[model samples]
Every structure is written in structure tokens, then in C-alpha cells.
Target chain A: MKCRKLKDSLSAYISEELSERQMSRMSRHLATCSACAGELASFKRLYERIDAVPQVLPSDDFEERFWRKVKDADAGSSSVKALPLFDWTLGFKWGVSVAVAVVVMVGAYFYLHTSYGDKARGKSEIAEMADIDRYLEFYKNYEVIKKMDFLIKLEKDKSLGDNNLPENRTL
Target chain B: MRYDRDTQLMLAFKRGDKKSFDILFKRYSVLLINYIYRFLGSRHKAEELAQEVLLKIYLAKDTYRPKAKFSTWVYRIATNACLNELRRHEYHHHSVSLDASGEENPVNRKVWMDDQAFTPEQSMEKRGFEEAFKEALKTLPERQKAAFLLNRFQNASYSEVAGALSCSVASVKSLIHRATVGLKDKLKDYII
Candidate 1:
């Protein structure tokens, strides 16, 4: 009704966004008010100038160039998909796995080197004691072992097909 | 479900009909280029973005549903692309040097102001009008500019603009209203 409200609606009025009731009301107001009519006229001029701005067309190769880009994109995406080796995510995964493995390995090495060394030394001492016991047992029966060694060597010569050797002479 | 012709064409492409896509392309290419050109004020960028929109529609064949009009979907994509570009740079100004080389330059746009039919005086007037129009266009916020361009130049309805902008029709009404008023205030000097 008032010019302020009507002024706000002018844009919608010119563009036909208003409902029919609003349109008729505004139409009636415009007919009575020269000031509103002048404002409407200038807004119309704005529309005309906006509409007059022309379009610029793409070049002749537009479609062709677009198709080419599509083809290149298709190629690029396919190649990336096909090769897991070329995938950055895959590389990242492998890198994380290797880092985790290295961490575990270093952790294991430190754990073994520090806390397990005494256990390993204890084991080696037992092994050394067994060796000593084995040598001591042979020395305890030194004469009998020497005699058994001669007999064992004769048995070995017999099994070696050395029939002509003195040890292999059964008679 | 009933679909618009373009949506049907897209569905047909989804069904492995490449010719349907060709039809859609032929239908939208020029219309889209003009819309983008008007939105971005750059011929080269408009052409580039139009191609991208087509490519997106092509790629979306399998995923597209008849949720909205094909035109609405298209304008949405085009709008998003234009907004991204505008947001990337604040678009400090749009200057056209008539002496500059053709389409490669953003400001070196080809316009009908250079029509041979116009007398030199008329051409000069048209030139001034276009310059003021461009400057006025840059002054509006990006969303207002988008709504104005779609509603004014693209012949989109308030509902259609709302669909494209992902806003309500009431918002579109307000946006377009503010845009028109803003442009009028800024261009008052040159229009008369």
C-alpha cells in the first residue's frame, strides 16, 4: 500500500514473482502514483540493460576438446585404479606397515639384548657344563674308550668296503 | 517415474545409450555456455565450466535420479562451480579492454556493443552501459548475483532458482529483489 512496501516488491513485481493478488494491488498503486511509476520505469531500464548484455560462444573445438579431456580423464583414472603399485594410499599403507615392523623389530632386539642376555648366558653355561661332563666321562674310561675306539675304527673300515685292510681281515 | 526429457535422456544413457547423451549435449551446450559466461564474466572460463558440467552429467548417468528437473540439477552444478571460482578469488573487478586479444583474456570478452549496425555514438553509449552493468554486477554478493543471473538471464522461475540454489523460493525472491535494487542503485548514473 505504502511506497516503502511497494518499493520492496518492485523487483519481484517486474520479474513477475508476486502472486496475482499482489500483482493487481501493485498494478493499481502504480497507476495512481507517478513517483512509483518513475521508480518502476528505471527498474525496467535496468532489466533492459541486463538483458542486452550478449553471450559469447565457445570455439569450434568445444565439443571435441571436451571429449578429449574426458578421454584423458578416463585414461588417467583407469591407470590409477589398475595399478595398486602406483596408488598413493597403497604406498602409505606399505609405509605404515614397514614402520610398524621396524618398531617391532627394534623393540624385540632391545628386549632380547637387555633382559634375555642373562638367560642366554645361563643356557650357554649349562651347555658348557654338559660339554665338560661329556669330556670328563670319556676320560673316566680313557683306557676302555681307546680300546673301543680301535674296535670302532675297524668296524668303520669293514663298512667302507676296504676288505684288503688289516682291520678288515676277519681271520 | 516421470522424468523431464533431459532426465529421460540421462536415464537412457545410463541404460547404455550413448546417443542419448549426445542429444542431451547438443541440447544444453550453448544454453549452459551462455549461462556460465553471464555468471563468470569470462568467455574462456564459461566454456571450460560448461564442458565440465557436461562431463559431470555424463559421468552421473548411472547415479542420477529423477529427484528434480534436469535443468535444476544442471543449474545447481553450474552454480556451484561458479561460486567455487568466485570464492577462490574475491573478483576485485571485471575489466574489458576492447583492444585486448580475443577469448583467452577474461576481460577481453566479445560483446554486441561492437555491432557494425550501431552508429559510433550509439556504440559508445552501449559500451558505457555494458561497462557500468559489469561493474554493478561485481558489486552484488555472489549468491545475489547467481540468483539474479539465473532468474533474469536464464529465465528461471523463483522456484527454479531456489532449486538451483538449494534455498527456499522466498529466499530466492528476496535475493533477486535485493540484487535488482543493488544493481539499480549502482547503475543509476549510466542507465539514464
Candidate 2:
């Protein structure tokens, strides 16, 4: 196998994850290849150095501190449970506030909607009434309005008659 | 037998046996501390986080189910705790001042180098390597770091790591491989 392929298999080989056939092939390659063998040794050494890093231990009173935390947590949880009424009241207050806000919003929406609808209807009614009044006023002067054209023709004829006079005539 | 013991102890703890809970704590506290230390690179933070993990285990006893090994569950919790702690701003901002003089200073805390009997030169070399390794470890992606640490430090099998990481075994292998490559590349200068 080429060194590149052998290098890819090096980690699995070092970790002992390679299959027997692959492992044997890798072993053979490493035997013949000095560079691959050196790489493997370096990997092994790195692993050893990593393994050699010392483990840090907890202090002697780790248990004591842990149990104290447990006790405190236990006490805190119990004290929280002790205020059942307060918890319920808090929930109740939030519910009531949300309900009140929702109700106010809904009521305001309906009120505004109804008022707007009423105002729109009232405006249309007033417009209709105004149209009726206008029509009535026109009808009230219907005869006079109907004679206006004749009156205008008579005035035109009179003016024509006046114009026929020499002083009023355009040459 | 080892597998069953932890599960059994957890079951007993769930059944209100306080002593069983104590036994579980005593058994895993050091391991959890060490595991978290690898992630946080701070012994103080690791101990604090380990305490939190134990507290979580204690409080969550009622929710315990025997679906998997108890160690896997513990590790899952510890891993999550470490990740959460890493996410905090304090974790990124905090530094260990070696010359700092205070009880609260992480530098004053006991470290692995303190307990080892080494020549001064050897100790300095080990400390240097450890610091370099930690820096390289910090550069790894979270999942890769978790997989590598669980597989290498915790001695968890790839399958166990997968279970702890909530990923498939294939993904765990990929994560560990990638982490190893990354660490190797970063620590190349230090490695002989």
C-alpha cells in the first residue's frame, strides 16, 4: 500500500480498530517503510504523553460540601413547596390580568366597531335626507324653473328690438 | 460485576437509601473531578463542577432508569455540566496567575504536579507539556474534545462515549480521530 493510504489507516491501527487483514497489510507496509514506521512511533509516543498527564483529585471535603449543597437544595425545594397558596395566588393573578386585558381589548374592539358602523349608517342617512331635501327644494320651485327658458327668450327678443334702433346698432 | 454494581447502587439510591447515594458519590467523585478537569483545565472549577454533577445526580435520583450503565449517565451529566461551564463568560476570562497569593486563587490549588515526586527539571518539563496539551485540547471542537477525553481519560469504550455523547459510535470514532489529528498537529513541536 502507498504511504498515504497507510497513513490514513494509522489511527485505526493505533486504536486497534483495523480489521485483521488490513492490520497485517499495514504492519507489512510499516515494516518496509521507514517513514510510516517513524510516523507510527510518533503517534504512539503522543498517546503515551497524553496518557501520562496526571489526574487531578477533588479536595478532602468534597463529600461534605456535596452533602451540604444537597441539604440546601432540599431545604430550598421544601420551602418553595411550603408556599402553595402564594404560588396559586401568583398564577391566579397572572390569569386574571391576562383575562382582563383580553376582555378589555375585545370589548374595545366591539365598541369601536359598533360605533363606527352606527356613525357610517348615520352619515349615509343624513346624506340621503340631504338628497331628499335638495330634491324637494327643486320641486318646490319647479314651475318657476320651468318658465325660466321662456323668460330668457322674451328678454333676448326685447334686446333684439332695442338693438334694431340706429343708436344701439353696430354698423 | 463492575457494570452491575453502579447500576445497583443507583437503584438503591433511588429507593431512598441515602447510604447508597453516599457510596456512589465517594466512588465517582474523583473520577468526575478528573474528567471535568481535563475539560476545564482548572482543578478548582473541576471540583466545583463535579459537586454540581453529584448534586444533579442526587436530585435526579427519582428519574433514574436502568436503560444503560450508570457510569454513562453520570458521564453524560458531567459532560453537559462541563460544556455549560465552558460556555460561561467567566470561563473564558479567568486565568490562573501563578504568582497570585490567595486561597481563592486557582494557582494556589493542589495540582497533579504537586503530588508527583520528580526532579525539578522533570517537573518543569511535565508542567510545560501539560500546559501545551491543555492548550491544544482547548482548541478542539466540543464534541471532539468530549469524545477524546471520554475515550482516553475516562477509559470509556467508543460505544460508551457514543452513549454519553448522544451520538453514534461511528461519529464518536470520527470525532476522536479528528481530535487526535488536531492535537498531534498542535503538539508536534513539543513531541520528540
Candidate 3:
């Protein structure tokens, strides 16, 4: 491998992540190339320095402060939920009020219509009964008038001739 | 069985056992803080970010499934939190000096000398090298930095790094390789 190619693979070589064939080629290149070998050594030293950085610990009150923050967040969220609940209650109240007003208007319309219909029906029935009574009175007067007409016809016949009126004195 | 303890502890916490959460917090707090410190390069910010991450884990307990390893799940959450923090600040401009003279800075207390027994001059040189290494790390792109940190510092395999990063293993390898090349270029002064 050329020095450029070998240098490109240096990270993988140092990390031990290369395939066996590539590792063998890189090893051969490094054996013959003093500059690449020096580069690999430097990478190793750098890795060591990176690993040697110290671990820093937090303050004594870290846990206490963290829990306090969590509690504050929970409180804030609950208050946010309360605002929506209030809006929902207000909406429900308005909806119910509008429904009651609509129902009352419909009921009043039906009640007025039914009362007018009942008054018109009662007037028509009174007119029909008066007509029936007037017809019955006219029928009774006609029967008396017909009997008078028969008696007048019998008197005229007796004045004309007694012989023409024989054996019919009951007429 | 290796991860059963943490898994059970997480499951218990999911079931509303608050004390189990405390135990989980104690176990991973320092580790997560240090990991975030590496990403942000500031102890104070790292601790704050770590607390946020733990709080997220606590709040999202119901979403936790024991299918994957507990450490992997926690690291995934921590990784996302650190990335978000980094993006929010447009990259932490406050550089933490490894050689800052203060008794409180633990990084300054633990020197990174190559030899176990070093003279004062070697310790000072190692400190300079560590500072340069940190600077080089800061220059890397976020994903590459995450890949390198998880692979090298956290001792995660390429596949595990992929899982935490939500990327393929091949992508992680490419990222770490590019990061290594970048670091080698930046720290050429110390190395060669």
C-alpha cells in the first residue's frame, strides 16, 4: 500500500476494526514506512491522553435541586390543564341555555296554534245545530196546512150538488 | 443478567417507586456529568445539563422499555440533551482550562502525565498537551465529537455508539475516523 492509502486506514487500524486482509497490508506498509509508523505512534499517544481526562462530579445539592425543578414543572402543567377545564365548563353552560330557549319557542308556537283551531271548530258546530232546528219547525207547519186543504174541497163538493155527493158525507 | 439490576431498578421506578429513581440517579449522575463535561468543557454547565437529562429520564419513565440495555437508553437521552445544550449556546464559548490553578478544579488536581512517576516539568508538559487535545476536540463537528467521545471515553463499541447516535455502525466508523484525522492534524505540534 502507498503511504497515503496506509495513512487513510490508520484510524481503523488503531481502533482494531479492520478486516484481516487490510490489517495485514497496513502492517506491512507500516513496517517499511518510518513516517507512517511515527504517525501511528502519535495517534496512540493522543488516544491515551484523551482517555486520561478526569471525571468531574456534581455539587452536593444536585439531587435536591433536580427534584425541586420537577415539582415546579408538574405544578405548571396542572395549572395549564385547569384553564382548558374552565373553558369547557363555560361552553357547556352556554350550550344548555341556547337549547332551553329553542325548546320554549317551539312549545309556545304549538300551544297558540291548538287554541285557535279549537275556537273555530266550536263556532261551526253551533251554526250546524241552528240549521237543523229551523228545518224541523217548517215540517210541523206543513202537516196542518195539508189537513185544511182536504176539508175545504169537501165543502165545495156539497154546495154544487147533493146527488153528486151521495154516500161520501165523511169527506 | 449483567444488566438485570439496572433494568429491574428502572422497571421499579416505572412502577412508581420513587426511591428506586434515587438509586438510579446516584449511580449515573457522576458518569453522565463527566460525559457532558467532555462535550461542553465546563463543569457547571455539565452539571446543569446532567440534571436536565436525569429529570427527562424521570419524566419519561413510562416510555422506558427493558428490551435494550439500561445504560444504552440513559446514554441516548444524555447524548440528545448534550447535543441540544450545545446547539442552544451555539457551542459553549467558555473554555475550561485543564491547567487552571484552583483547588476546586478536579481536572487540575489529576494531572495526565504519561509516566506514573513524573517530574514537575513533565507534569506541566502533559497539562499543555491535554489543553491542546481539548481544543482540538472542540473544533470537531458535533456528530464526530459525539462518536469519538462515546467510542473512546465511554468505551462503547461502534455498534453501541451507533445506537446512541441513531446512526448506522458504518457511519459511526466514518465519523470517528474523520474525527481522528482532524485531531491528528490539529495536535500535530504535540505529536510530531
Top candidate by TM-score: 1
- Mind sharing the TM-score for model 1? 0.64
Question: What fraction of the native interface does candidate 1 get right in terms of contacts?
Answer: 0.79
TM-score of each candidate structure, all chains considered together: 0.64, 0.63, 0.59
What is every candidate's C-alpha DockQ against the true complex, given to 2 decimals?
0.48, 0.39, 0.38
| Tens-digit per-residue lDDT, B1-192, candidate 1 | 777788888889999999999998988888889888777778898899999999999878878787898889999898888766664554534432212223244443322222233432443466777766665565556567788888887788999888888878877877787888877776776568
Error of model 1, residue B107, in angstroms: 26
Q: After aligning candidate 2 to the native by TM-score, how far in Å is the CA of B144 from where it should be?
A: 1.5
Candidate 2: where are CA atoms >4 Å away? A1-6, A18-29, A81-171, B1-3, B90-127
Question: Taking the tens digit of each residue's C-alpha lDDT, what string does model 3 give over B1-192?
Answer: 455687889889999998999998998898888788777677798889888888888887888877676777778888778766764664533322212223234432222222234332453467686666665666666667777887887777787787887777777778787788777776666655
DockQ top scorer: 1
Candidate 2 local Cα displacement, residue A164, angstroms: 99
Model 3: residues with Cα > 4 Å off, grouped in runs: A1-6, A19-35, A74-171, B1-5, B92-127
Ranked by TM-score, the better of candidates 1 and 2 is 1
The better-scoring model by lDDT among 1 and 2 is 1
Pick the winner on TM-score between candidates 2 and 3. 2
Q: How far in Å is the alpha carbon of A119 misplaced in model 1?
A: 40
Of the candidates numbered 1 and 2, which has the greater DockQ value? 1
Pairs of residues at least 3 apart in sequence or in different chains that clash in candidate 1? none
Clashes of each: 0, 0, 0
